[model samples]
Target: MIKAVFIDFYGTVVYEDGEVIQKVSQEIFVSGKVNDKSEIGSYWWNEFQTAFNNAYGDSFKAQRILEYKSLEKTIKHFKSSADAVKLSNLMFRHWIEPPIFEESKQFFELCPVPIYVLSNIDRADVLQAIKYHGLKPAGVFTSEDAKSYKPRKELFEFALNNVGLSAGEVLHIGDSLSSDIKGASSVGINAIWVNRNNREIPSGVTAVKNLIEIFDTKYFLHE
Candidate 1:
């Protein structure tokens, strides 16, 4: 039987703003267009990753700088950092509140097992999202708190340790194959992919587009 359930934040619990709703970005409102890491190259996406693999890694700070620069552009656009911060915070808040699924509230409230969060995000951001959405988690495990992102075994391991459980005792729900799926499975925690967009499940794991599917405790858990 499952003792606990770990859910991903973005994509699974909350959704990035789509065209239907206009959401603000605190970064954008307070600052501006974020730095063009692309100006550095497509490799810029991995800039943070590359730094991590090196001995003298300082990529988090570098990533923060990039964000700062991007926000700076917004400041130039709005002519005020305070306004940008307000707007951006509003947008950030939008992304977190209400969530992506009508079933989110039901499942969260009805889960038969303990529910927790395992996400690749800053600790403050995750807490803000949880508070805004009224998401009550038994525990929270974030990339910033773990000091490592998903696909890294330690990050998942950290959450498990915090909850005082083994991989077999919990089920992890997430969207990304590389991060959530692979990361949780690597440590023996069964992963259920929330492919809300109807994407094919990548080879190796089970997937369900709807959260309601996994709400059945008997499916993934040992009875």
Candidate 2:
């Protein structure tokens, strides 16, 4: 049986509003040749992951700084007349204040135990999202605190230790098959893949289409 529930913030709990980002990008990168302004937003996100993948603990950088740098590079490559710094600022601000998934909100409202956030994000950004969404988690922990990102065990251990629970006692739920499912399970915590995209689940991985599906599953209700 689960004693505590650990949720991931981005993609799992809320999504960065793509439409908003797309709209902002069009205003900034207004050009006759560019028919797909949304590519700017897409490139920004792709560069966001590229930045994270290139990040390191010994040479740590804040998420905001990385976002700005990555987006600036992306904008330059695309030859947009927009101010890369300004566009990056707008993108990061929109990211910090994201739309909370209604199903995630309802799940948080009804989860059986205290909920805490276990995310790969800057503390400030995650906290802001939590506050804006009124998530009111029992606690929030992140890579900025752990000095490492998930799929790495240190972050998970840090969260478990703070909550005073063994890995076996907590249930971790998130969207990534690699980071959320494998990461938690590797550390002995049971995990449910919040597969919002209906991706194919690998053998032995627990999955749900969304948080609402968790309430219907025996996994959440039973041991």
Candidate 3:
């Protein structure tokens, strides 16, 4: 029996910062000699992920700091004159005010189990977003709180301890395969993938196209 649900905040419960990232990337691309705008986006994401992967344990850095550092590298790589700090600030603002999905509101209203946010974002950003959207989750956990990001067991373990539930007692749902699915599974917790983009589902993994699909009797138990 599932006692609670652990859901991811950005890209899962609400819109991601893709638009703001695109806007920033476009500004950089326009200033730089890059031929393809997509290249800027790809490079920025790759840089951020590399930074994120390296951040853990004694080397832990807040997501905001990582974003700033990654943006600086991206700017330098493209030879763009844009200020990394300014662009990173824009991304932070968007993270704090991302639009909640309509179906998410419906899921919140109907989900029988208590829902807690288990995200890889900064604590303040996710908290502000929860307030901005008028959400009342059972609790919110973030990388800042655990001093480690997702795909690392520390964050998930921290969340489980706070929620007072064993790994098998809760279900974690999120959009990222590596972060949410792999992370949760690593700790013996069941997870559902919110594959909104119709990506190919891997074997033995359960998936849904949207939040509403979570209510399917096969995946969720009302009890």
Candidate 4:
């Protein structure tokens, strides 16, 4: 029986920084240095992911710093004059104050088990956001706390150890397939994908459109 839930903070509980990222990408495209706005977005994400995957242990770096460096590299790669600091700051602001999903409030209010935040974001950013949105999870865990990011197992392990629960006794819910699903599965935790976009669900992966669906009779029941 599931004793608790581990939910992702950014995309699961609140909106991501996609809007600010799109704006930054558009700015780069308008500079005429990049051929397509989509390319800018793709390149930036690739750079950031690469950096994040390599960051761990003594080489660990904060998410905000990685974001800034990735943006800097993207600008240089496209020969764009966009101010990396300014663009990164814009992204950080959104990360700290992204709109909370309407359903999140409802789900939290009615959840049967204790919910803890398991996120790949910086500690301070997620903590500030939780406060800003008036969220009170049982606990909050971050990459910074573990000195490692998600999909790496270290962060998940760190969170599990602190929650004092066996992997089989916890369920993880998050939007990212690679990070949340894979990470939780690595540690033997069941995961439910919050596929808000109606994307194709892979074989053996249970998915829901939103948090409310988690309580469906087909999934799990309250108590």
Candidate 5:
């Protein structure tokens, strides 16, 4: 039986408004120069992934730092405004808090099991999000706490260890197919992907569309 639920933060509990950033960033920079916002987004994501992966072993780069570096690079590389650093600083301030999902708020209230947030965010920002949303989970764990990130079993193990529960006793739920589902499974935890975008349910992986679906008696309780 599952004793606790571990959920991801960003895409699961809260959703980031990327469009807001895109519009604002473009306004701050040269729109004529940065023709495709999606292109810049993809480039920023690639830089973040590279930094995150490189920091896995010993180096520890905070999410905010990565954001600054990525945004800085994107701005300069595109030959936008000369004030790239200033623009990114403005963006980073806005990036700290994300809007909480309505379904996630309801899940926190309705779920019978103890729930915790396990995310790959810096400690301060994670705590800020929790407070801003008024979330009262059993606990909050982040990359800052683990000194590593998701898609790595070590972080999953850290959450399991902190909860003092065996992998079998906990259920991990998140939006990422690779990080949440695979990482939790790597340590024997049952995981469900929160596929809100109607993605295909890959073989060997269980999924739910909304957070409430898992609580549906007819759908998941029988399992």
Candidate 6:
């Protein structure tokens, strides 16, 4: 008897075009003499993710800034730390502007359940994405608000507490097995991994190839 559903933002609901990689590459690593936009873009993207996670994990801007500066130096084929910061912000903005999946849009309209967004983004960006895509959900939760990140049960518990629902009554959906699935399960919530890469399903978690599959709520309800 699931009463609620929580979905992840970036890869789960929407995804950026591969052009985002080219943008970051030309701006950052390419100017610095790095080879291969795809490889460089992948490196910077990983660094960007690490910066945010370290920021949220430690619950302080100072440490995260320091971490970002360090990564800036590490990737210094092009510019200084200050410039790197600007490049990172630019890349981040592009990264969040994912094209909404048309099937997800229609599926959300017909799904007969409470829906929410849970992400490791700031409130402002979450709001921006929600509005930009005309998404309507019962609520939005972010790691910035939680003062921590997913894969840490406390963050999931915080969202659960806010919604006033027991873990059993809610379903958590996201793309990351380590974060979304493990974090949700730690709090006793059922999790579904939105496996975009056709990866093997980790043990003890349900999964789907796309958000549209969740329309068949019956399949998950019995799990």
TM-score, every prediction: 0.71, 0.84, 0.96, 0.96, 0.88, 0.80
**Error of model 3, residue 55, in angstroms:** 0.8
Whole-model lDDT per candidate:
0.66, 0.79, 0.90, 0.89, 0.79, 0.71
lDDT of 4 by residue, 10-104 (tens): 89999988888888998777874866678888898899989998999999999999999999999989888888889889988987888999899
Which pairs clash (backbone N, Cα, C closer than 3 Å) in model 2? Answer: none
The regions of model 3 sitting more than 4 angstroms off are: none
Rank candidates by lDDT, best first. 3, 4, 2, 5, 6, 1
After superposition on all C-alphas, the RMSD of every candidate to the true structure, in Å, is 5.7, 2.8, 1.3, 1.2, 2.5, 3.6
lDDT (0-100) at residue 58 of candidate 3? 87
* Candidate 6 worst ten-residue window by lDDT: 58-67
Return the top candidate by TM-score. 4
Tens digits of per-residue lDDT for model 3 on 1-223? 8888999989999999888988899889988879999999899889999989989988999999998988998899999999888898898998889988879988988898999999888998999999998888989999988889999999899999998899999899999999999999999999999999999999989999999888884647545
Model 5 C-alpha lDDT per residue in residues 1-223, reported as the tens digit of each score: 7789999988888886465567656653554377665677677678878987776657877877877787677776766664656666555554467777778888999878889889887878778878888889999888878878898887888888999999988989999988888888889989888988998899978888988888863334855
Show where candidate 2 strays beyond 4 Å: 20-47
- The local distance difference test score of model 1 is 0.66
Model 2, position 133: C-alpha lDDT score: 82
* lDDT per residue as tens, model 1, 1-223: 6788989977788774442122333333334344542332233234435544331223343223333344445356544444545544454555446365677877788787889998766576677888887878888887666666777787788888899999988889988888789889899999888888887766867888778788553555444
Question: Per-residue lDDT tens digits of candidate 2, residues 36-91?
Answer: 76676677778877777666678667777787787677667677666766666676
For model 3 the TM-score comes to 0.96
Best by lDDT: 3
Clashing residue pairs for model 4 = none
* lDDT, residue 199, candidate 4: 99
Model 6 score (lDDT): 0.71
Would you give me the overall lDDT of model 4? 0.89
Candidate 6, 50-164: lDDT as tens digits: 6656665455343235435645754674452336666556646754566776677876786677888888766676678778888898999887777777777767888889999
Once fitted onto the true fold, the runs of candidate 4 whose alpha carbons sit more than 4 angstroms away are 217-219
